[model samples]
Target: MYQLNLARSLAAGSVFGQNAVKCSQMLVSEGKLEPESFNIAIGVAAKMRGQANLRAFHEHYLEKTSEFRANKVVRRFQEAIDSLSIGSLGNILVEARTTRIRPTTRSTGLDEGVRL
Candidate 1:
């Protein structure tokens, strides 16, 4: 559990990719293909452990629909957490980040056309 948070904080872009180019790049630099550890650390710094703990409860337990009982929700949360380790999540985050490209906007000159 702690490892997952630590990984999220250290990995870049909040994604992981098995075949991502970035992973390759990291491997080239560090001799192993892994998400950026520094970025994960940054994530941890940005969101401290206390805040994360509180958020987990709120997001996983309180935020669910009425049909979802608290215990059930908590069990689900535990399942999910157990399924993936922090390193895996960070890797996924890195992959997700790599795929995300800022949307490009082209000036249409519509505002210029409507002169004051």
Candidate 2:
């Protein structure tokens, strides 16, 4: 878990970042990759637009236990990969951004004129 968290942090923020992907691949190859870890890798790959890494991770995920497929996060990651493959990633991003559940004044219970 520590390694997975470190890999995700490095992938998200480090200037020398491809190493993080390599670390994830090594974990997958050694059968040490958890479903959550794979989800993290998928997220990083999608954010970085690393098509090759995404494909590799997808293949590795498939080869793992069927129980992993039951994980919602893993399923979502797979859907993201599928969207990328079908060239609908841009549409998905636009829809997700436009459909966000913004906090309303009623929800926050603060006056609309009040500044934070």
Query: Residue by residue across 26-104, what tens digits does model 1's lDDT show?
Result: 4446654334664443333323333445446756656565535655766665566556554555555546644578786
Full-model lDDT for every candidate: 0.48, 0.54
Q: Show the colliding residue pairs in model 2.
A: none
lDDT of 2 by residue, 15-88 (tens): 32554465457657788656555445444444555445555566666677454653544567656666553224
Tell me the spans in candidate 1 whose CA falls farther than 4 Å from its real position: 1-68, 97-116
Q: Against the hidden true structure, what lDDT does model 2 obtain?
A: 0.54
Model 1 deviation from the true structure expressed as Cα RMSD, one decimal place:
11.7
How well does candidate 1 match the true structure in TM-score terms?
A: 0.33
Best by TM-score: 1
**Shift of residue 51 alpha carbon in model 1, Å:** 9.2
